[model samples]
Target: MIREFDRWAYDNRLRAWRAEWKLIVAFVMLAVVMMGGWREQWLVLIGMAYWIVARARVPFSVYGKAMLAASVFLGLSLLTLVVSVSVPFQITFIDSQLQPAAKLAVRSLAAWSCLFFLLITTPAPDLIAVLRRMRLPAALVELCFLMYRFIFLLEQAAAELMLALRARSGGTHWRHGGMLMYQLWMKTWQSYEAFSRSLAARGGVASAGHTHQREKAHVPLVDVAAGIIMALLLGWAWRKG
Candidate 1:
């Protein structure tokens, strides 16, 4: 899935548009995503889906898979906020936690969708280039690139672990799931250590092309107009509500 996003990022319909343009749109919508209530959140989510799926020409299935993968993590994190997930698995939810949990869930999903828009349309290195152009700290920018690289490493490790567990063919016990995660953690660390060793030997910097080259990319006027209109409507809805 990570590969899919990166692949599409380079090949998407929005590739010709300025990466800065996409960044601005995503960041501005984040303001509305954070400040506005559920109504604004829903509107932003729909609008982003249209941009990513329809306008950007990303397959709906790929978007759906990404959302489902994201939702698992989101749901578990939110679950812990409202319900205690300790030993014995008590299904307890405080009355006060429910409302805030719902709000947080809505906010997080909208935010993730905005990020997906960016990830699917802009290459990872290009984004790093954008950050460097903005004068972001070099250390922070390098960290971002390493993290982006690890997503692929982690995915490969997870795929192998799943296959191994399936071959073992045990009962559907909770411990099996835990063991899979534990093995995955160990495998990932080993791979990371090997990567570090080889990188140290080479003395070459990671692939974050330090040259922040600018391209004369075109920004579509109609798309800009649509974004402005959507932002205005979301703002109006937030204020009126």
Candidate 2:
């Protein structure tokens, strides 16, 4: 069932929508980065949150995990700052730093959440197709394609290595964990080496030739409207803030 839903989500129309929306989202994030203000950061957080929840339909369970982790780090940092407070430590500057850091955590979570959605909803083939359509250099597209393809191969290799290690059933605990760690590291290295050789042998052509592919994308009216709306919203956010 999950696989079916994922397949539907990666359909051409949805893939195009995700690609366009993500580009807009990235632009908003870039603006926030340049402005370097807490207000702009908050806007990025909101934009990312909307993209994840509304478009991606990420479960609250997953979001909760990220929120908890961020909260723990932020809380610890704040506590440390408060406990280390001194007369020489300017309170205003400390507070100012704290504001940006907190906003950064929120924005990072939001952006990651959107990326997670993309990974879940989009298939690798369709994503590469979209990038090709966007005029990304052929070399970059091929590299991106190979990286994604090999990640799963590497993960499976790691998993099998772990199972083999466990099957040994020798006295393996934290003290002997180093052996397993070394084995896993070597497996990953070798897997990547082999993957690289395969990629080279294939002439780094990860996908079918773009010969039959469209030379340009047909940007839908909905995409144009969304762009206008996002621009207005961002402008308002900047002025109001």
Candidate 3:
């Protein structure tokens, strides 16, 4: 899970500065090359995968599992791009459609890999701190903070509820699943209401602001130079594409 990744990231030497630079540089190149050709996208994907597996030292199993989950959703969404329906509801693949779908799939995979690299190498708190330093909107940052905090809380609550249900039912069933889902929703809503009241009690939403000032991070000059090189490469790829 993400919590395990966070712990691993903090224990590793590549936690803050290197991870932040890689995150920014990788995504910038990804965005630029994503607008280019499939060749460029594939290049970006390979570079990112190498950095993640070799440089960042993320385990292949972790990367594979994450990509597999993403591919499932990406494949489903891409079905519309590749498949067309005829008058008789016959599904057909047009030759022209294949190119666009391939381009999209490559670009998407590159983007997802870049994102996963950042997620596995940087903890949420450090990432939020970086975002704050980058002058992101306070409200948006705060929303993300709350969402991150509550996701674990909600997951724990759901797990406990499911365990109780299983103890009573002896096994899972459609009816049990439905009951568990309903209870989870109700619990989530109640928790949100309580949080809202608590926030209200402490003046207003504006008072919920928490300053995230950490020790100044020192990004290596080499990384900055590399980022510049990547930008130039992306420009060339764009023109070539």
Candidate 4:
């Protein structure tokens, strides 16, 4: 996925420019302002603006999914809060409780945006290289690789389970709900058992790669400048806040 984003970014000429540094600075300043108890609605506005400008140069599809996922989660969380509080707290729509929700949302958005930007833009292999360069243990890196591979397998298994359920249940109408759920549980268990058995047969250490060759790439000047500016902005935000 990271490789796909790299290809897309390069294809679209969405490489970093000098103005991106200014946007990063502005985001940091807004984050500080947000920490000073800005109105929830205002904070949300600023947070979104920060995300938009910060992600502007990246391939839209790469970052758009992150934004959409965050929005969905935020909406669901806000809805749950509103429903739970409507009686005791006398809250109405989302706007009535916007301040608290906005506070939570903005902080989450900031942290997620920071991490997502770093991950989507940075090559996965380069990340490993940097970690190795910093003397991280080989065992940990191997664990990371294994975990990444397993996650995709797990996701595929989950999709198959969902499809099987959908085929048998036909939208899980009330008449078939209980039976459908039972079938799903049985199928899920069988899937897990199969996966565990496969893992055990593989000596519980699948994909044991030998002779790892570390690929080398020259770090560009722009990447260095971007890192420095981001670090300074982060430091300033921390101290000023």
Candidate 3 Cα RMSD (Å): 3.5
User: Residue 110 error for model 2, in Å?
Assistant: 4.2
Task: Give TM per candidate.
Answer: 0.79, 0.62, 0.79, 0.54
Better of 1 and 3 by TM-score: 1
The window of 10 residues in a row where model 4 has the poorest summed lDDT is 11-20
lDDT (Cα, tens digit) per residue for candidate 2, span 1-241? 2333344455434354555555545655665645645565566566555544554555545555655766677677666543445688753445546665666566655555445556544566666877887899988987787676666666677667668777876536775577766877888888778867987998875464432222235556755676577567767777877
Q: Write the per-residue lDDT of candidate 1 for residues 4-82, one digit (tens) a residue.
A: 8788998788888777888988988888899888999989988899899988899999899988888889888887778
How far off is residue 52 in model 1, in Å? 1.0
Candidate 2's C-alpha runs over 4 A off are 1-18, 33-36, 65-97, 110-121, 170-172, 193-233
What clash pairs does model 2 have? none
lDDT of 3 by residue, 1-241 (tens): 6566666566543554644675676577667565677767776777667656765677777778788888999999988988898999798987888888877887888888877767776777777777777899988888888888888888888988999998888646788888988999999999999988987798776623445325447755654575566567766776787
List the candidate 3 regions with Cα displacement exceeding 4 Å: 16-20, 84-96, 202-240
Compose the digit string of candidate 4's lDDT tens values, residues 103-179: 67766665556555444444444455555556888888767765655555555655665577678766566755565
What's the CA RMSD for each of the models? 3.6, 6.3, 3.5, 7.0
Query: Order the candidates by lDDT, highest first — what do you get?
Result: 1, 3, 2, 4
TM-score of candidate 1 against the unseen true structure: 0.79
Ranked candidates, highest TM-score first: 1, 3, 2, 4
> Against the unseen true structure, what C-alpha lDDT does each candidate score?
0.84, 0.60, 0.73, 0.55
Question: Candidate 2 has what TM-score?
Answer: 0.62
